[model samples]
Target chain A: MEGLNTVGLVEVLTLDGLDDVVRVLRDQGRKVIGPIVRDGVITHDEFDSVSELPHGWTEDQDGGRYRLVPTGTDEVFGFSSPSTSWKRYLYPERTLLIRARRDNGTVEVVQPQPDAPAVAFFGIRSCDLVALGILDRVFLDREATDPTYAARRSDVFIVAAACNRPGKTCFCASMDTGPTPRSGFDLSVRELHGDGRHEFLVEAGSERGTELLATIASRRATTADLDTAQALHGRAAASMGRRMDPQDPPLAALDPDHPRWDDVANRCLACGNCTMVCPTCFCNATEDSTNLTGTEAERWRVWDSCFSIDFSHLHGGSVRSTVKSRYRQWLLHKLVTWHDQFDVSGCVGCGRCITWCPVGIDLTAEITALATPQQSAGRKGVPS
Target chain B: MTPRMYEVVARRDDLPDTVTLTLAPVDEQCPTPAIGQFNMLWAFGIGEAPISLAGFENGHLIHTIRRVGAVTNSLAASTTGDQIGVRGPYGTGWDLTRAAGRDVLVVAGGLGLAPVRPIITELFANRSSYGRAVLLVGARTPDALLYRDELEQWRGRLDIEVEVTVDSATPSWRGDVGVVTRLVERAPIDPENTTAFVCGPEVMMRFAAVSVVDRGVPAAEVMLSLERNMHCAIGHCGHCQLGPEFICKDGPVVPWPRVKPLLRVAER
Candidate 1:
């Protein structure tokens, strides 16, 4: 209860002040990772320099399209969120589980090394934060707490920046993931503009964030600054170009034979780009590794996607052979059934699936297409 | 010093296409496994597969496997003295203590027999502790029934009722010819004093649960072993998740009432 009510706030930072914050976090031995402009698209990658940050950049996205363009402002946090997220730092692409050696007609079992990296993930959005919370239901629940995920998660701190600008594919408002996060972050910042000056309003949500904020050179927030922060959030909400049906049973509308799935399957590449960029998708596959000596071998687990044909393979054949079935499974599991299974909706409404998809397979559009007649007639064909 | 891995000492081609392998712990003292639990058996160079204990608890561990996947096909190809690694007898198992003093109904359909067989053996070993024991087994055909010779021995015992059936049958075979649920309909069970455990295909268990519940058995009194794609026996892997309950943890043995909602969904 103490964690819920204790909202901490502070003086806003200008665009130029971001480098100082990164320096302070890195000086504390944290690996700072964020969206960096690469090959024309803003993507998540390791960063040590403020120059690598996507400054004066904006993304254009629609069903089956994504593009990076120059924004008129020099503000580093002025742009909308990226298509990728911070889940990669918690659950990597691959990691070893066990190693074994056979000698003298006997075998030995060995445990793999644990991750101990302290991470400071910058530019995390509210939807991505909610996605992490849904994942926490799986990886950190009482029955099966993933040690690898837990180790990385506990050592990390989040520096979530609120959405000042939303892309065409953005829909965090409908999902309530937001223009602002309710919980699951150490710190959140809302960028504000006042009389030709840009400033970031800061709020600490956890003790780790409180400690990190203590090192930052900032005074406490005034009532007027709070009003400015609220006004900034309202502007972001008004600018939202995408919205999902807040009332629609979150991803549950996707049926195996849903006509909407057939529509997307036609343009979809089955390249798994959507899942790769998704912050909450946690399906994985395993592999066995052998050392050069042939005497030592290790078992490894790696991220996998349901879009792959082999993801649901049975003995003689694959259960979901077509792109249609795979897409249906992905959407339904993320939205509807996940609620029944895990008591949480799988999607955080980050809009990354809509943005990064090469063919621009918009999830919100598909859901709208599948929306029941009563909802469609009343809600103007789109939930958002 | 390293932890010792178990090795397959002997392999017996038991029923048609089914092989029984004996595993001996590499260490002098083997970690004892529990009834209704399973091991992640890995072929030396291939991969791992989950297999239930067919014979063990008397010390010599045995696994009855049917050649199904890449790992299983390779495991079936192993010689009598081939070596492999064993991880766990993980997850919560059948609470045999809960079944004590009650008449127990142990139903198996095809390969489902392997997982619950050890529980039957344990039940028989402590025969007087329970009221009565019944085993109703159904396979695809006569040739597919596992533990045939053992079935005969259990049949002769006065303490247990053992019956076999097949969905389809050969001309020479003269056993009950119907689905396993048909056998359940004819059997007389005192639902108040009985606890039924069902394992097999989802359809078989679904039908069997209907029959058991019709006989006045409470939903909590009937248990089913679910089969899911369990890559990691540890609860961490989401592959085996069925609702909030991880099939690998909350159960591979769950009360019918607990899993009814999940079973309705197509994905699970």
Candidate 2:
């Protein structure tokens, strides 16, 4: 508590002190959401106590696979990534825009009020923090802001957790997004376990974080603790299971008729799982519904994917009707055109699209395949 | 954003399936739309569709809609006094100032003609500001033509030239019968000073744009209005993306060079 007066002040806390951190946030009228074991997988949900956190649990994630395993050590905040990203909370799956009623001979329209609450996001990883910034660029920092996403994102507080144990599907080091929490959080915690000790190194990143840290019982962090945290982060960064060249090939230059697309299309189901789990894919469609009396109606915006045939529908028919075309759009939009649109790469190397893909379509492998030279003889009988 | 209320002042059947409606705001006035821009019209219990401004008459917005989907069908069924939700004057518009003191070539196919009606009207209103003006229109058949009376009236003018073409014709038809690109090939105009505005189906625009550029018109001087599935006309919805461009925000109207390569890619 003596070291909590300034930003960037490091403090040490016990496992019990971490529980008090959650208690203080809840006392300040913030809904606390963090990692919880639900449906046999680590996911995010609102919880009241630290006991709800997925302690001693980590996950094994590879292309097309995910399994939660207990590490036999009671180390909280040990998970690499959740099954879904924080976009589900900030940009919800569905939001109502307007409600209209037909009365007598005229129609009346009413704009729906946004349902937003002050939330404290606990255990958010560094890549997801970068994803939050990308979503902000798409929704808030634009010509016209999405009022619903703006309302939800305005009053949220972030408590980030450093990923000292990177997952097998993680490549955030290559994307330069994580392993250690660098910015965009009010408070950051690194779990230090081993040597018969279970403690956390907490740092204050904002004034509000300093005030909250002052209320809890903690001691100033020693140089040895800081060194241990740095060493662990360095080890995590060097041991990422996946790798991608940050300088990607210009995807637009690749031939649209490349045979690799056909090979991927044969395995791709267009099931849209990758879009749903992705933290930054922001396509949506509107749904209008009427009551039985036909007097009341509401328009709701729901999540949509480019892989769907109807995403490109026009007066005559769908534009990207073929599976090959849809897949190509998804790949090019994510890797190449996103820079033209947002001035940044759309992918943060979270690897959710690879793990969640039913057929294990690794994007990094696909990029390699597309970049490699192929023999012209193989293209003779390829289907368009 | 929520839509403002607009009441239908009048409706006319342009064809068996196409209806043109005159909409006037009930209270708050909607922003005036430029030639190539469009509005997201909401049919009370249905949904919204982006419809371009056909023209303006007296102060009301003229929208020519062909019944194709759920929202358009509901919009087409509305009577004179019915109220509907309307928003936007969204997307880029045709920059007429770019054509000052230049010959103008207008090419439209089928319902694509609706988006360019205002362009033709603006040209005639300031006839002295521009050089020779020609309009070429193409439809599937003789009976499918839009603005038949207006075309006849324009054909009578000696100051401007108007030509109509059909894919097929009956015995009584005497006009040109072929794809609209043929009109671009044989139109008597100096390509050095002509600015062309082309809009229609994607395939039609592709061919027409190529033909215009082939005739020595600069690709930068040729404009084409694009159509795509849109939800949030403000560009938050990602359905209208073509390559890196969001058709709803960056354009419904774009210069030819900007979209030529994108159009060449199948299903882009």
Quick one: best DockQ, which candidate?
2
Candidate 2 local lDDT, B146-238, one digit each (tens): 998998999999988888999999898989999999999988778989999998988889889989988888889999999999998987889
Q: How many residue pairs clash in each candidate?
A: 12, 0
How many backbone clashes can be found in candidate 2? Answer: 0
Could you tell me every candidate's TM-score relative to the true structure?
0.87, 0.96
Tens-place lDDT per residue, model 2, A1-384, is 212334576889998899999999999999999999999899899999989999899999999999999899888887797998999788899998999999875889999878898899999998898899988989996678888899989888888899878888899998898878787888899998999988899988888887888888988899888888888888888988897775766565666667898899999999899999888898899999999999999999999999999999987899899898899999889888988898887888888999899999998889888877674322232122
RMSD of each: 5.2, 2.9
Compute the lDDT for candidate 2: 0.88
Q: List the DockQ of the predictions in order.
A: 0.27, 0.60
Ten residues in a row with the worst lDDT in model 2 chain B? Answer: B259-268
Alpha-carbon error at A270 in model 2, in Å?
Answer: 0.5
